[model samples]
Target chain A: MKQRHYKYIVPILLGTLFSCQKSSNNEDFNQIVEANPIETEVDVSSEIAMQVIEQMPSPLEISAIIKKTGLSYNSGILNPITHMENYTTNSQKAINFGIYATDLGYVNMYNSSQDAMNYLETVSSLSQDLNVSHFFNFELLQKLATNEQNLDSLMHISTQNFEEINDYLAKSQRGDLGALIIAGGWIEGMYLACEVHQKSDHKSLREKIGDQKVSLSSLISLMNAYKSNPDVELINKDLMKLQNIFNKIQVKEHTRESKVIEEDGIPMYQDKKVLTVMVTDDEINQIRTLVIDLRNRLVK
Target chain B: MTLKRLFISCFMLNSFIMSSECNLEEFSKNAAQKLAGYTYLKTYKLDASKEAEIEYSYVFSNNTQYVLTLAHELETTDILVSIYDNNRKELCNNYDKKGKKYFQGIGYSCSATGIYYVMFSFKNAKNKCGASVLGFKK
Candidate 1:
């Protein structure tokens, strides 16, 4: 048994030795690992596999896609800022915090400074209620929201702040709350996408909605990690329903080597494969109806 | 020498068995500025487990030009990144094998939407503190 231990451990020691020699950033390994925010005892269950929610596209991605369509801004489509007070529980606060962040993103995308400021204040309030306000720079964000030229910075900072809050929550024992934030943000993004689609019936937007199948399964798996919580369990049940509808959409995939081109000394690859997303009008309607209904139920 | 090896064996056992994390207080913002002309979407702090590579999956939409900007406390772009399509097909890498050069990021424009797995590793197994930020423009 002792000889076996040496055989496996020697190689790791040599690897560490080489790593330490080449390491330019000489951080004290033990101290740094001790201070890592991801050191929390995660309660993520193991039944569901591929549980990675951290890299899911920002809730703002759908908003960015919607804004590029030249659709007119509609404040009525957003969750009302006045409803921020109704969420008293930690779960409610975290979820609404995410919803308000997405709403704030939409407001920023349209360059509505006044509306952005309102959403910013409300998001800050909710983040405060959730004890995550330290992750946000409310004054700087408010200042940026007032200037239309700062729209990009405002959007980036808002998204980054929400990411920080989620990270902090994950570091503590509240990773379930982080999952809830993602769930809320994702549902609101879909709701906004569906509502915008209802307005114009954009063909590309429909495909984009269908393309969300990739993240949908991962989000569902992530939610299942925290299914022990009542809020997470209920949300996961609804997400599974969404997943079922998404499962019905057909996507044919093929792959080939991308044509690589050099841009400013960087490699930019143009993917050759194109997938035709086959989502019928009926499926779209089902997804849209369910998204709107689910979002409304959560917020109301 | 035998005692030293024994101590290292025990230490390695502890590290390999436990979860690895990094101390990246402000990882993303520091790198986002480098990749201008693109709107920041998502950022990931790399776990500093040198023995293992970090893999993150993101759903990238086609027709949108996306860039994955990498930053490190090492102050060099020598960090290794390999991007794979949803099918785990190799798409592109930051290393220039011909020129022996390393770029700071990978730019990808796909014609189809799928989950792309971005893997980041350090060349010398020295990946304790670094991050990757994903930015896009349609």
Candidate 2:
């Protein structure tokens, strides 16, 4: 009876050991499979896939387009959309404005030159084409070449462009239309001043471009000197108005857009918000003062 | 018997743990050094004028044979290039032409190694230009 009992227990223990070994091997195989990186082959629909690929942005091509636009603008073959209207507006507004302003400093400046007045009268008929205020400045510069009386007014007008530009810049963020317009006017003013300096051999006018810095006060001073007639009280009054406006400007920073994200913490490209901007109120008073100063210098 | 088996198993496990710990320090040290040495360089502008002299220095490894480069949109109407050895002895001067415009030519001998200088001189020019340099090593 004892032998029979031992034999049964030994067989049962052997069977249990074999079963445990099999379960351990199965667990090990499962763990190895789980640890390996799995790659799934997705069978994309050719028609849909091709359409999606075509719609993706090509960075190289986009950059090339932007470069071409810049080149065209630089070459003057294509007037930038930002200033196209200014080129077409009444040319006389510029001539009249320039001559009248300059006369305030030196009455002799416009004595023999009715050329600017004539040009202004001609341009007034086409005022609809002018896009920005600087277009008027350009005409004024052209008239100033013949009419010396336009110098003080030209200075007042050009200086106002700078003040208005700074105001616009203060109110808007970088890359905005306001910034582009301001840059356009600044370039126009600088270009005119450079041309005049080259033609007349004016050392002071030439020096204006040398520093490469643009400020309201500096521009006002430049205009004051270029007027060249100390007897003119109107020029002095305009300069003071410019100073008052520049002192009151203030700027504020703000975020204009926010990004959208996916539920899994990944950013969604289509929902990306770009462009940060800051606005200020201090420059507006300067702009108003500049405009008033320019008008006062020109109307008289 | 049970105590002896348990002790042997613990001893084997301890040995495995200690060996892995030793390798971890070496791997981390190498990673830290590599991260510390990396850097970035950017070029903003390069200008050459008739009034201003151009100064340049270059180096080559033992196997380097030849170097070729191109300069475009030069501010000067004419460009002249001169190469010199470490002792300041003149090596060669070459004139490069593209259509009606002339540029600076760049070339070197294979047997030369160490530091060499190339000077570029120009006259009456304007606008921004680009330069591309290509070198061969043995």
- In order of appearance, the predictions have TM-scores of 0.79, 0.22
Stretches off by above 4 angstroms in model 1 are A1-42, A45-51, A254-257, B1-30, B45-52, B72-77, B124-130
The sequence of per-residue lDDT tens digits that candidate 2 reaches over residues B1-138 is 999999999999998665433232233223222211111000101244222555444442222233333444334334455566545566654453334434333444423223444555544544322332323322
Two-chain complex of model 1, DockQ on C-alpha atoms against the true structure: 0.29
Per-residue alpha-carbon lDDT of candidate 2 for residues A78-197, written as tens digits (9 for 90 to 100): 112233234322222332322222221122122334433433333333222333344345565556646565544443343334333333322332112222222223333333333333
- Superposed by TM-score, candidate 2 places the C-alpha of residue A202 at a distance from the truth, in angstroms, of 38
- Model 1 TM-score, all chains together: 0.79
Residue A12 lDDT (model 1): 32
Query: With candidate 1 superimposed using the best TM-score fit, by how many Å does residue A28's alpha carbon deviate from the native?
Result: 34
Best by lDDT: 1
